[model samples]
Target: MGKNLREPLLKLLIEQKEGYISGEEISQRLICSRTAIWKHINELRSEGYQIEAKPKAGYRLVYRPDRVAPEELIPHLSTTSIGRAVRYQRSVPSTQSLAHEWAKEGAQEGSLYLTEEQTAGRGRMGRIWHSPTHSGIWMSLILRPPIPLNQSPQLTLLTSVAITRALRKQTNLPIQIKWPNDLLIHGKKVCGILTELRGEQDQVHYVVQGIGINVNATESVWPEELRPIATSLAIEGGRTFSRPELIGAICGELETLYDGYLSYGFTPIRILWEEYAGMLGQEVTARTGQGSVKGIAKGLAETGALLLETHTGVQTIFSSDIEW
Candidate 1:
């Protein structure tokens, strides 16, 4: 069985919606032998797909696992190449780490790497991102931009805007962007973005933007520490969302913003991001390695740094913990 045969077989099974599909039918439609069809079915099953097989009744797709695959997402995706090329894994240590390695090895820009679960997912400031199996979107993208290294933080802001837009498109839930790189739903954390860059002294060589969204995680599925403050799309929307749809939306928005940044600059993205950012124009506390500072969240600077109006004066905060 070839790679091309799997997609048509899956689509046929989905379209048929019948309890069983005969091996003779699959073999005829795919123009392959029954043995070849069986081989491909086994391959699909190995990839966590649940298929029921009977000696005479043939096969039936009992379950389609919530995993990000190029075949599943690309057909419905509306973008140039942001998610056109995907490397999907059932489980991995970290999608970001894998994306970083791929980017370093000259992977194409807009390449996406996703996993069903991440064992060592991380968030901003070295925080651990809870990515459980079959419950969230654990994905990373490789981007090659001509922007300077100092303007890299803007990428994080851009990603936030993209994710927020995607969530809004799929569900009517009100989503807000926390300062820097957190996505909140009804004032609870629902998503986090971690952006990393590898470059020279002046120019950015590549950037790996990692995003994790709590899609279908239930209250009991979350850790005790996060139950109070964390949430999932299912909890917020009262239903589970297609991870592939959300991923496609995010990748499309990202490509749009990336093109905008290259043409006009970060000014447009900064404006849009500020509109959705939480704590802006409100009293907030910022915790940094140096110390903590209380200030009013004025807005973001043109360079994407945090503009904090402190007691002494206005400050440009590049990175810090935001508490509102």
Candidate 2:
């Protein structure tokens, strides 16, 4: 606690790896007392690290935690700016709400707000997103794009593509995108994205891209109501994953796609999205607030809207809940 000994202490432990580092050695290396070193070790343990302390053998680094804290994620992050500025919380009502507040106060582009638990997580169309404690990823990333407001909606499609690509790279799970912001694996929902922008119709100020991923939750851990429609990476892969690694991979994917979009345009993203779009060319029914339309899901419009080929002709679906 004195002058922030956590990072230095963790550095010492990591340097030792599986080998034991005595308390006196750590104290001497870090210029701190043995008691202070012990305190910092306990702090690391509380953060989910598995450390072993012997009576006379000192401490050994066992394994790192599966957490998304800045300390955990920053070390693994490869993005230039996307996850460079991270605000981590143990619990929050919604990362989206916090990101919106920071965006209003002029938070930098690529700033991230991540939490382990969300009490009131939200999804599209006012649906409640189930976010229990330490079972998934509840995070929001802030961006200030230079494009017009109309192009902002395309960010959702871009994000879905990014996540699907990242998961495929990480887990090789054959991930697919459910148009307009859902990631599915083996036809079960694994991730959801919500993009919110604030600005005039001409110019945009900021965009809060909120993402919720059911990463490591077991089948029994899912709510009874969501068991049929929801599944997690752990449930599908039959193993757990490092949250920090997954978060870092996603940030890197987003940064790459976002930079590409800024330079080339949404055309590139639209092409990638179409490759993983499970609804394309399939007969589906989409219901909006106004009414419902049954049609074959065609390709995306140049503006990123879903082009539905219906009996009434091609209907552009800007927003809807699809059923196939």
Pick the TM-score winner. 2
lDDT of 2 by residue, 216-314 (tens): 987787679899999998888888888888988999999999999999999999999899998899998889889999999998998999999999899
The numbered model that scores best in lDDT is: 2
Q: Which stretches of candidate 1 lie over 4 Å from their true place?
A: 17-32, 46-62
Clashing pairs in 1: none
TM-score of 2: 0.92
Q: List the candidate 2 regions with Cα displacement exceeding 4 Å.
A: 1-5, 22-36, 53-58
What are the root-mean-square deviations of the candidates from the true structure over C-alphas?
Answer: 2.4, 2.2
Using all chains and alpha carbons, the TM-scores for the candidates as numbered come to 0.91, 0.92
